[model samples]
Target: MHDSSVFLIEFGAIILGLGLLGRLAGRLRFSPIPLYLLAGLAFGEGGLYPLGTSEEFVAIGAEIGVVLLLLMLGLEYTASDLVSNLKTQYPAGLVDAALNALPGAAMALLLGWGPVAAVVLAGVTWISSSGVIAKVLGDLGRLGNRETPVILSILVLEDLSMAVYLPIITALLAGVGLAAGSLTLAVALGVAGLVLLIAVRYGRHISRFVSSDDSEKLLLVVLGLTLLVAGIAQKLQVSAAVGAFLVGIALSGEVAEGAHHLLAPLRDLFAAVFFVFFGLHTDPSSIPPVLLPALALAFVTTLTKIATGYWAAKRAGISARGRWRAGGTLVARGEFSIVIAGLAVTAGIEPSLGPLATAYVLILVILGPLTARYTEPLARRLTRRPRPEQPLAPPAQATPVDDQDTVGRT
Candidate 1:
């Protein structure tokens, strides 16, 4: 009874705090993400106070949060959309990887955390926050812009890459031998490929299985299936997030639409818990020591992300303004960055990684919206060249017709 009381008190406080923080963010026209992280820091270890009983529940909720995030993201596009984007926008995806991923890898290695940490950090830096970007686009009314599709295509490619990247990272973190790791990776890939094929070829049948006329029944059925698939994927050395994503992709039509609408509120709630949960694990005091490096990394990656967006938009033949907008829009990294860092933190790969990632994400999430709003104007202001002044044109004369008439008469 005593432990249960404490759990209720703590968990209740967490939910209430998240609600208030979200309201505050809405009022301030800011993303609640950084505030949620700060709240977690305040209530987590090495902060003002710590929860005694709710941590376990928060952790479970956090995992669910990640699954829902990827799942909703997958619902935004169809299986056909994924294949089309992969085929057409692959060059941009490659450029996104090369330009953005290397900075984090270099930072990790430079810090003497070695190769595994390098790989983890590379992912942290590489993927942009699709959630954040989507929200910003909606907020700023950029959904209809010429470069928006280009941006969406690039984001789709990144999410697809994760279907492969997460499994390999899972194998690496497991500390298996080379052959074992290769086998694990092969299994993971095979599973993912098979899921995709199923989604593409038999998606309608899959949707029919989960489809229900009632929202309550549909929610329970879809949620249960997602959790089941995610658990099985984790057991098979695959990414639970990826499994959830594939499940989402397999459903289409009214079922997908209904699932998205019904599940959005739940997704938001759990996702907030997840961000706070990440913060709870990271020690606030540790963040200060790595704050400088995190800022530097954030600065460098902001430019790299911008460069990536610009190149992609230009390739798609976007106008200068649209290209600049695209680059700026991609600057912010949020949930996925934390997800990647969370994996490293859980594996005890580098003690400083959690703090560094926390600080890095906090910096960019705040800066991301501002840049998205201002980048085009800022770029135009900075790179614009003044035109030379021209000589004044001679005043028009009215005597020419009269002169011709006089000469003819003479």
Candidate 2:
């Protein structure tokens, strides 16, 4: 009875603190991710005053947080969309991996962390933060810009790649041999292919099966299904995140929309907890030792991400300004990077990895928004390029992109 009371008091205070921090971040027009990590650090193992009872609950919440994060991300597109993006935008995806992932792999090897840790860190650096980028696009009104589709295509490809990448990492971290790891990869690929096939052919039927007019029933059913699949996936040695993502892809139309609308708040709450939970396990003192390495990584990857965006946009024939925007937009790394590092940390792969990832993400997540807003303008200033001049009289307005049929075409 005493323990229960303490748990309630500690957790209640945590939620309240997160709320206040989130509010502060909103006022500053910044993501609250860094602040949440800081909160966790202050209250975690080596920090000010760690809580005893709530750590277990926070751990569970964090896992759910990761599952929900991937699930909702899947809901944003159809299986067909993933296929199409892969077909059309794979060049960008390959370039993205080569440019962004290699640096991380190099860093890990340079630190003598071995091949497995290298692969893990490669993922940590390769993927951009979809959540942060989506928000920046909305806030900046770039949704209709010429390069927006290019940016989105790159993001979609990244999401698709994770379906395969997560399983390989999971197997590697488990210390499975080559034969067993190959089997795991084959299984993951087969499952992904099967799910995509089902989604492409019978998605509507699946949606109908899950659909409910009552919001309460709908919410429970969808959430229950996601968790169930996630658990089974974990049991099968596939990543639970991949399973949740597949479930999301399997639902479409009204069902997907309703599920997304219903699940977003829950996702946000759990996702915040997940980040804090990661911090809870990391010692604050470990971070300073890794701070310089994290900074170097963050700097190098920022440029590489920009280069990737620029190259991708150029391939799609975007203008100089739009290209810069696309590159700048991909600079921030967030949830996915941590998700990768979290797997490694949980596997006890390297003592320094968790601290390094924590510091690295904190730096980039904060810088992501600033880069998104400024990189293009900064490029212009550096080049001393004058803005295209308008005629004295209001020139004939160009036809809308749809009518003109080109500028923003993907």
Off by over 4 Å in 1: 393-410
TM-score of each: 0.94, 0.94
lDDT (Cα, tens digit) per residue for candidate 1, span 287-358: 988999899999999999899889999998787888889999999889999998998888998999999999
Per-residue lDDT of candidate 2, residues 1-410 (tens digit): 34898999999999999999999998998888888888889999899998789999999999999999999999999999999998899999999999999999999999999999999999999999999899888888788787889889988888889999999999999999999999999999999999999999999999999999999999999999999999999888889999999999999999999999999999999999998888888899999999999999999999999999989988988878888899999998989999999999899989999999999999999999999999998998998967687668675887644322134445
Q: How accurate locally is residue 275 in candidate 2, as Cα lDDT from 0 to 100?
A: 87
Q: Which residue pairs collide, candidate 2?
A: none
lDDT of each: 0.90, 0.92
- Which residue window of length 10 is worst by lDDT in model 2? 400-409
Which candidate's lDDT is highest? 2
Q: How many backbone clashes does candidate 1 have?
A: 0
Query: What is the overall TM-score of model 2 with all chains considered together?
Result: 0.94
